[model samples]
Target: MTRVLVTGAKGQLGSDLKELSVHLQNIKFTFIDIDELDITSTEAISDFFSGQVFDYLINSAAYTAVDKAESDKETAFQVNAEAINSLISVIRKSQTKFIHISTDYVFSGDHNIPYTEDFQVNPQSTYGKSKLKGEEYVLQYENGMIIRTAWLYSSYGQNFVKSILKKGREKEELKVVNDQLGSPTYSGHLAKAILDIINKDMDNSIPFKPEIFHFTNAGVCSWFDFALKIKELAYLPCRILPVSTEQYPLPAKRPAYSVLSKEKIISKYKINIPDWKTGLKDCLGKLGELR
Candidate 1:
């Protein structure tokens, strides 16, 4: 059996991975949140890896407070950048195949075309910079693969989808920025993609390559388009007012156009990426089940 260690087990993506692991007959998963493992401490990671070995390490843990990262630089860097070094050390020692999750924020959003993996990264925010640093650290290990996604949401965590549903149910009107462009990635889809890669590796169908890849739902849309779809899917009678980024200012600057190119990942893995509308519908349906 393939022994896998997933960090940030309670996170949206990590939770989805754990949920799917039940049906993976050939894989044995060990899930751990920060409470069970402090990834910032090298000693802790070294001690933990010394006891047991894992075939793969999926690092879904991250400091995702985008707006708060501006003021909380220390915590963000600790978790996003510095802590990654600790994981890298342990991954090297155990010869584990490392899979790290990154963000589309690494781009400056200055391009009119979709951002590709080889695009020059110029992150505009502290969060983006920190995540880029973490990507750099993981890339040092040739066995590690970095997957960058955008606008992630899931039933297990608080995200834009749930927030829109909640506010759409309570408020009569909601204003969403129309200038920001990206794709909404369902955590469940991403989790399945990750597992698919591991499965192929296990069967020797494809050799695991240490490279950066972009994984998001098929199409792109602005925040306004996303909100309208959310309200329609949830059957909520709420007016979604489209607004510009200038009208609503945030503490952290966001990418105006961060649509990632899926050409590379699609050709390499032969994965079928779902459309944004389809992904949203599936996520909302799962959310309804819980309520």
Candidate 2:
């Protein structure tokens, strides 16, 4: 059996992975959140790894409060960057494959085209910078694999989809920013992709390679487009208006164009990616909000 350790078991991606794990074969998952293990403490990680050995460690824990990270930079780096260093220090001797989840915020989002893996990263927010630091630590590890994703949402947690669903039903009109463009990733789909990679590696269908990869649902749209689609799908009779980013000022600056290119992961893993709309529909169905 393949022993896999998944951190951030309470988050959307981790939860999705746990739910999906039940249907798979020859894999035993040990899910832990901060309550079970404090990743920020190097001694804590060392002690945890003392008795247990895992074939793979899937790190999904992160400081994802984008606007809040502007003021709480220390906590953000501690969780996002320092914790990764701690994990690497302990896992180095065990030779465990480390799969870390990252965000599209690592880019400046100034381009008109999709972001490739090798594009020069220029993060514009505190959250992005901190995540980038974590990526640096992971890159230094010979066994590390970084999967950068964007606009993640799921049925299990608080996300844009749930937020829009709630407000769209209660409010008569809504205004969303039209300038920011990116792809929406359903955490369920991402969870499946992760498991697919792990299974392929274990079965020798495709050997595991330590490299950065991008994963997201196909197609791109702005926040306004996203909200409009949500309203349409939920059958909410609300007027949705599109506004510029300037109209809605946020504490943390978001990438205007952070759509990640899926060519590398798709071709290398031979995984079929669903369109964003399809993902959204499935997610809504899971939430029992699909009309």
Candidate 3:
């Protein structure tokens, strides 16, 4: 069996991948949440990797408290940067294939067009910088892939979808940024796509190195537009006021437009990753199971 280790297994993506394990073949998974495995500790990493071997390591663990990250950069770098460095060193010796999850924050959202893998990265915040460093470390590894995804949400964790639904019910109106634009990726969709890519292409020429690939649901929308859809689908009576990024200023300087280009991932994997609205409906339909 090809043993796969998914770190941060309790997180949204990790949990989604865990759910995906049901339909998998020939690959066995070992999920380690923070309690089971601490990625920040070298001693723990050493002990874990020394005892059990894995063919692939999917790092979904991250210091993802975005607003809190602005205040706790050291902790963020420790988990997002230094800890990833440790994982790379260990995985390198085992010659393991690593799939490091990263964010779209690496790019400055100044561009009007969709962000591409080859585009210049100009992160505007500490969180973005730290995640970019994590990407750099994984990219340094020869047999690794740094997948950059954005606007993610799921049932297992604190995400935009849940937040919107919660707040919409509580309040008569909500203010979401109309300026920021990106695909609202349901975590399960990306999880399935990543697994499919690995299942199909583990052997050939090994296409890209530390190869940065963008994966998100098909199509695009602003935060305001996204919230409107959420309200409509969930049958909530909430008036959404589309505001600029300035109106709802956050500690993090998220790019105005971080919509990642999916042509590479879509074409290479030949998987029909659906639109955000379609995926959202599936997720909501199963919201009971999710709950």
Candidate 4:
């Protein structure tokens, strides 16, 4: 059996992985959140890994409070960057394949085209910088792999979809920034993709390689487009208005064009990625809000 350790078990991606694991055969998962392990402390990780061995470690834990990260940079770096450093140091001796989830924020929103894996990154936000640092740390491990994703949401947690639904129901109109553009990825789909890679590796269909890959739902849309779709799918009577990013100032700078190129992951893993609309509909159905 393939023993997999998934951190951030309570997070959106981690929770989705846990739900999907039930039907998976020949794999045993050990899911743990911050309560179960303090990844920031090197000693804690060393002690935790000393007792058990895992074939894989999927790290879905992160500090994702984008706006709050502007002020709480210390906590963000500690959780996002320092924690990976500790994990890599402790797992250096183990043969565990480390799969770490990263964000699209690592790139500056200055491009008009989809960012390839080798795109020169210039993160504009503190959160992005910290995540990039974590990516650097993961690169030190020979068996480490990084999967950078964008605009992640799920039925299990608070996300843009749920937020828009709530605000749409309570307000007559909602203003969403139209300037920012990226793919809206459903956590469930990402979880399945991760598992597919692992299963293929186990079966020797696709050998595991330490490299960065991008995964997001197909197509691109702005925040306004996302909100409009959410309102339409949920049967909410709210007017969704498009506004410029300048009009809706946020503490953290979002990528104007962070649409990641999925060509590498798609061709390499042969993973079928659904369109963003389909993913949104699935998520709404799971939330019991789909019309």
Candidate 4: stretches off by over 4 Å: none
- The local distance difference test score of model 1 is 0.92
Ranked by lDDT from best down, the candidates are 2, 4, 1, 3
For model 4, the run of ten residues with the poorest summed lDDT: 87-96
lDDT for each residue of candidate 4 in 1-291, tens digit (9 for 90 to 100): 899999999999999999999989799999999998988877788889987999999999999999999999999999999999889877777868999999899999889999999999899999999999999999989999999999999998899998999999999999999989999999999999999999999999899999999999999999899998998899999899999999998999988998999999999998899999999999999989988
Q: Which candidate leads in lDDT?
A: 2
Could you give candidate 2's per-residue lDDT for residues 5-98 as a string of tens digits? 9999999999999999999879999999999899998888988999899999999999999999999999999999999999998999989999
Worst lDDT run of 10 residues, candidate 1, spans 282-291
TM-score of 4: 0.99
Candidate 2 segments whose C-alpha is farther than 4 A from its true place: none
Provide the clash count, candidate 1.
0
Error of 3 at 271 (Å): 1.6
- Look at candidate 3 and tell me the lDDT of residue 235: 85
Local distance difference test values of all predictions, in order: 0.92, 0.95, 0.87, 0.94
Which consecutive 10 residues in model 2 have the weakest lDDT in total? 38-47
Whole-model alpha-carbon lDDT for candidate 3? 0.87
Candidate 3 lDDT over residue span 129-191, tens digit each: 999989888878898898899989887788888888888889988999898899999999989
The TM-scores, one per candidate, come to 0.98, 0.99, 0.95, 0.99
Question: Candidate 1 versus the native: TM-score?
Answer: 0.98
Q: Rank the candidates by TM-score, best first.
A: 2, 4, 1, 3
